[model samples]
Target: MTSASELLALRSELTGSLVLPGDDAYEAARTPWNLSVDQRPAAIAEPADIADLQAILRTATAAGLGVTVQPNGHGANGDLSGVVLIRPKRFDLLAVDEQARVLRAGAGVNWGRALERLDGTGLVALAGSNPEVNVVALAIAGGQSMFSRRYGITARSIISVEFVDAAGTVHRVSDADDAELMWALRGGGGLFGIVTEIELALYPGDAIFGGGLMFPAEVAEAVVTAAFELARDEPELGLDVGMMHFPDAPQAPPHLRGRTVATVALVHVGDEATGRAFADRIVAVAEPISDTLTSFTIGSLAAVAAEPVEPMPSADFGVALDGLDDAFAREFVDAFTRGAARGLTRCGIRAMGGAIADELGAEFAAVGATQADALMSCSVLLFDPTIDVDAAFAPMRDLAARYPGGATLPTFLSSGATLADAYDRDVLDRLAAVKQRVDPGGVIRSNRPLG
Candidate 1:
């Protein structure tokens, strides 16, 4: 354990604030976005700039302590004990190069702020469904966005990364500077170092025809079948489908409370007329109870899923499927409904093909190079203390076992799986070599540690 005097000495060298275990701000500083994860680090440091970050890393290394980086604490896995929790919330930097069609964002910049900054610029950054997620973290984890079908994974769009390795050496890594480190940083889950900033290529076009179509619970099987067929027929169309179970709670809206519904969300890059025609094809297969498809700007894409903005306790179960056949679709629908009956609140599968498979080269990045047609995930809200978490996840596990395909994406991976489960042997070996070279002491700890 680090002594109080030693911590004070280290704090004196930093321009940022450091909170000890007994400090009033310690709890909030160390808390993760997922309320279920209980992380107890020895200290929490919020770096104001790159200098402060480097000092923190050097001090932690001298003290023989591990370092865990959490920009917004979205992917916390509860393994932060006995480490120095570094939150770069003060590193507020955002720059757009319209001429080059690129965006340079700091670790603290969220998708919401980035989208707002580029509102009417006729340009869009590759971002995920939840606008509140940190842009740097998502890019590092191989972000799957609304435009993934046309543009490929967000990691592939990275132009450069500015990070500080475990030895306190800062590096501006790119394909030109260091190809191996850059590839590892993309979708490798922060195993090498702390990423302070990232530059990503942006896409043109400001608008997309996107929204969701909700159907009654009774017709969930039909909805799933239709959604799979649409994705198979038009791989270029950005699509996702889900079966949500709203619990009977006062916190939920009156209309959604105690209801089960299936929804097919669409995001078409083509013109409004073509998007409408695609919607018509889906509706013709099975009429929807509620349809909100319309022409919208890229900034409004986050509203399609309407995921929760506030932090809450939740557990996730996910799987990658080779293809969604008729038999698999029926089994999936039945499993989802059964899990819903057993307290599974949200379950969905996002289509993964087109640019995701075609553009993701085997050696390009650590993720997104999958042969799977779609990725399915089931999540259970843990608001009720009496709920059985294991029982709620059983159906999802069984469903995934039925159609296991290639490795799972790092972004959707949950705890308990080894690195081999998420990557092939060769990729794992390469990642290990990078980890050994950059972080030999294994001071940089992440959810999926290659070291």
Candidate 2:
């Protein structure tokens, strides 16, 4: 264990800040974005520059302490203990090469900041719905993109990576320079090294259209089935549907409490007319309680999810599935509703196909569910610490078992999931070998570690 004195000394090595155990600020410093997770890390270090990073690594190696990097702790699992939790928020760097059609972001840079610059550039990155998510985190975990059907997964858009190895060595890598590490970084999670920066290829797009609709519980089945029917074979359109049930409690939203609502959000990487026509068809199913579809640029796409920015206790459960026929859609919606009645606050499904399922030959990165037709997920807030997350997710797991697509992505894995859950046996073995070679002493740890 790194003692209080050694951790205290680490403060002088960093330009940013370090909070050790027993300090008044330790609890808040050690806390992650997912309030459900309880991570009692030994120390929380925020290094401002590359020099500070080297100093941290040197000190950590001497003390036999492993270091894990979390820009904002969006992917915090529950098992962090006795490690130095490094937050790279001070490493803020954002640059776009318009001529080259590439975006370079530092570890601290989030999609919101990047999108702000790309708003009028006629270029779009492989960004996800939540603009608060760090760009590097999304790229490393192969996060599902708002334009994934057009641009593929975020990992495939990676052009290069700048990272610091476990031995305090800094390296800038790409497919041509370090093919193995580059492939691993593409979608192998953050297990090999502490990534400092990344560059993503940008796509041509001056405008993107999206809209949100919220329907009452009465037409939930009809709305769910309509989404699947309209979304099939449409490569440029992305549809994300959700069934949210709010309980009569303080944790629920004030305006939405004691209600079950079916929400639909669509993003189309095309012109205004086609997108509006599609929205009109969705409105014809049943008059929605609310409609907010309109033509806009990629910058305004963040509003579709309208996700909460503040930290909260949340449990995420996800599964990849084969196509759900109309009958199965009804059955699944019924099952999902019943599961939500049990405890799940929201059950979400994203139409996955087009570029997402296209295999990039044999030398491609290790991304999960490359051929999946759809991705289903469930989430529940664990405000009551006594609630068991696994138990709350059991029904969804049972349902997933019946329609298993045989794989799930790392970004969608449950908080307690391991690499095995997102990878095949052969792929996982290759990952293990890479880990053993790159981090022999295991100085670099991840939220989702090799174990």
Candidate 3:
């Protein structure tokens, strides 16, 4: 075991910023984006190089201190008491192989930077709905996206991964080599190892047709009704629709921007003519107050959804359904618009299927429990961090209970305590076994519910 002196010696070997428990920067280093999470880790280590990461890992393992790694601290697992954190501010390696159609990035890189770097290359990675989120954390957590219907989850596009194991060893994992670890890394979150860098398959994103369409609140029901009908037959169009409610204010646009109204953001990753035609059909159902559906690059797609750029206290709840019927679609629209208190909620239901549901014939599983219904993911956010979480979650619990069938999205499950609540028993059991085999001492615990 590493003594305090030995730990100090190991720390001296690193050239990156290291924050100990009582250091001034320690508090900032340990804190996550979600203000509700308050973890007092033993130390926060930022490794400047792969060798430095190896040293930290070895020291932590010898010290018997659990390790928790995060790229940008978006969705940390749980309280990190008595553990150490590996923040990747120092590991910012990015490489793009155009011939291979893949881009490799260090785990610490943010989505916006990656998108900016890959711009004009005719290649784009599967970024999160929000740009500020980290690439590695999102992929490890099995991210969902605006283009999920066409490309599947972020993990599916991963071509290779480089991580440091619990034993303080480095390993490179790919589909052709170390296939088991590759499969586990896809949707397993961070149960197995701490990823240093990951290689992902990039898609051509020169000019994809995608943007938001604003509709009047008066016809939210009719608009959603027609949208559900269009989604049913046009599964091949790679379309995604998100329903939003914006408060009436001068800060919003002149059209439907300032009004507390319903809006849908649509993206058709096809030719401009075909995409514009689909938009025309959608608008025909209900004349929208404003329509901005136009051609855009993949990097700019984040603006269409326009999710908050700043970090805030956020809570998410979801339901996966068996089928999409008019009754269910109407119910979904009503909950976000008519049912919400003051109509102050921003809700979206991504009609997931098509390419995502294709038979990949891999042991790695997909959260496909709902084969009959459309998957509805709901997120509720409060700009102020001081709001009481219990009060905020009360309405969401009620909403989940009111759904046609009650089930949470695995990716949206916020707490480590709710892992089983998100995933089924069989999936949880398999993850537990894999965790046991890889980290026998449970040395790599985080805000994850692997129990």
Candidate 4:
């Protein structure tokens, strides 16, 4: 173990600071963005620069420890007993090369910042719903975007990665520079090294006609029908349908308060008429109480889902399906109906066809969702930490068992999930081979590792 004296002395070498076991801030420092996660790293280090990062690696080597990075900790694992957590707070760098049509952001930059920066630039990158998630993290973990139908997944958009290997050596890795490492960096879940920054290819953007419509829970099947119909016929639209049970709390949106509603959120990268006609299919199913579907610039893409930006205790259960059968729609709706009064807050099914279903390059990262046709998930969000997990989500687990299928995206993997849940056996073996070659001693770690 790293002695207390050595750990204390190591702090003096950093421009930032460190919080060890006994420090008052240690408890808060180790907690992840998802308050439900409880990880106890031996120490938490805030590396101001590359030198500070190396210093932590040196100390970990001396202490016989593994190093892991969790800048925002959206995907924090259950246990981190022997690892040192490195929070790259100062790695916040966001730059856009308009002429080249590229985006270079450090690990600290979140989707919210990137979207705000590219607001009216007539350029759009593959970004997710939750704005607070780091852009680098999302892309590296094989992000699913509102534009996936046209642009593909976020990982495939990565042009280059600035990484620090297990030896604490900084290297700029690209497809040409290091094909093997670049392949792993794209979607291998940060197991190979610690990335400082990444360059992403940006796509052209115009005003988008997108938003959401909330229908009564009784019409959920029709809304689901509309979702799959669009996924099959309209390959250009981006939308997701979910059954949500909003709590009757002061913090809850007044419109969604104390109701179990079926909501369809979407974005069509085209004119208003085209988007409205697509939405009308859902409207034709039943009269919606709430409709916010409108035309806006791609800059406002993050606002479509209206996902909460705050942190709370939440449990997510997800799975991938090869293809949905005729029975799935009823199975999904009926399962959640029995679950809502119990604790299942929201269950959603988003079609993942088109470019998203297209395979990554043979040499690129192994993102399993690209092979699957759709992604489904159920989540339970509680206010306090004392929530009974098994009691709250047992029905979800039972429901998940009913759908025997393929793999989920790494980002959608349930808590305590291993890489095996997101990749096939062959892919797992390939990732393990890469891990052995790049991190022989297992010096670097991430939320999801090959182990």
For all the candidates, what are their Cα RMSDs to the real structure? 1.7, 1.8, 3.3, 2.0
Question: What tens digits encode model 3's per-residue C-alpha lDDT throughout 55-165?
Answer: 877787788777888767776756777677888876788888877888888988888788777777877677775778888877776676666666666777877888888
Evaluate model 2: give its TM-score: 0.96
User: 237 in model 1: Cα distance from truth in Å?
Assistant: 1.5
**Stretches > 4 Å off in candidate 2:** 250-255, 384-391
- Global lDDT for candidate 1? 0.81
The CA lDDT at 76 in model 4 is 93
- After TM-score superposition, what is the CA distance of residue 137 in candidate 3 from its true location, in Å? 1.9
> Can you tell me which runs of candidate 3 are displaced by over 4 Å?
1-10, 237-259, 342-344, 362-373, 383-409, 416-418
Give the higher-TM-score candidate: 1 or 3.
1
- Steric clash pairs (candidate 4): none
Off by over 4 Å in 1: 1-4, 359-362, 416-418
Clash totals for all candidate models: 0, 0, 8, 0
- Taken over the whole model, the C-alpha lDDT of each candidate is 0.81, 0.81, 0.68, 0.81
Encode model 1's per-residue lDDT on 101-198: one tens digit a residue: 99999888888888777767778777887878999888887778878877788888888999988888888989898889888877787788988989
| Winner on lDDT (3 vs 4) | 4
RMSD of 4: 2.0
How do these models rank on TM-score, best leading? 1, 2, 4, 3
